[model samples]
Target: MKTREISKRKCIGCGEMKPKKELIRIVKNKEGEVSIDKVGKKPGRGAYVCNSLECLEKGMKSRRVERSFKMKIEQEIYDKLKEEIVNE
Candidate 1:
């Protein structure tokens, strides 16, 4: 019998390694549209974060997601992330 492997992604917010399903995904597409990607199927650069508001705050304060994606993250993206975190 073979054990299935769980895909792991590092959380940009808290610097923790979490399974894909356990974290929320934020994607920046080639067109430069940044949004919270709950489905994780969006095509483009992606950042992983936990579901907690604390994680989102930490990420926003430190710009960890910006570091991960190698691009300047706009305030609107942070707003969307906060909105998604709250909805979750």
Candidate 2:
């Protein structure tokens, strides 16, 4: 039997490489809207982060998401992401 390989992505916050399924994806759509891609199927540029407040805060403090998406992110989007992370 053959085993499939798992995809990995770097966490923008902690700068660690982790399995894609284990990280949270933040996507920016073509319309320039940003949101959390819970299913990881959203079409757009995506940035990964760990599922923790520390990672989230680090990402925010460093503005990694903004850099990855090449645009300014609203505080509301970050707030929404934080809420989702906490709820999860």
Candidate 3:
């Protein structure tokens, strides 16, 4: 029998390693657009965060997500992410 591998990702907010499916993916595509990747199948630079607003705020305050993407993120983007997290 073959064993399946569980993919793990680090959360930029809480800085914890967790299963990929349990985290929210934020992607920056070739066009330099950042958005939440609910399906986790986007081709771009990706950062992971927990599914909680607290983690989102922590990532925002620490600038971890911005550093991960190596660019300046706008307030609108953060707001969008927050809304998504809340809805989830």
RMSD of each: 1.1, 0.9, 0.7
lDDT tens digits by residue: candidate 3, 1-88? 9999999999999999999999999999999999999999999999999999999999999999999999999999999989988988
TM-score of every model versus the real structure: 0.91, 0.95, 0.96
8 Cα displacement, candidate 2 (Å) = 0.6
Clash totals in order: 0, 0, 0
lDDT of 1 by residue, 1-88 (tens): 9999999998877889989999998888999778888788989988888999898889888988888778887787788778878988
lDDT of 2 by residue, 15-68 (tens): 999999999999999999998899999999999999998998999999988999
lDDT of each structure? 0.86, 0.94, 0.95
Ten-residue region with minimum lDDT total, candidate 2: 56-65
* Candidate 2: regions farther than 4 A off: none
lDDT of 2: 0.94
How far does residue 10 in candidate 2 sit from its true spot (Å)? 0.4
Candidate 3 — which residues are off by over 4 angstroms? Answer: none
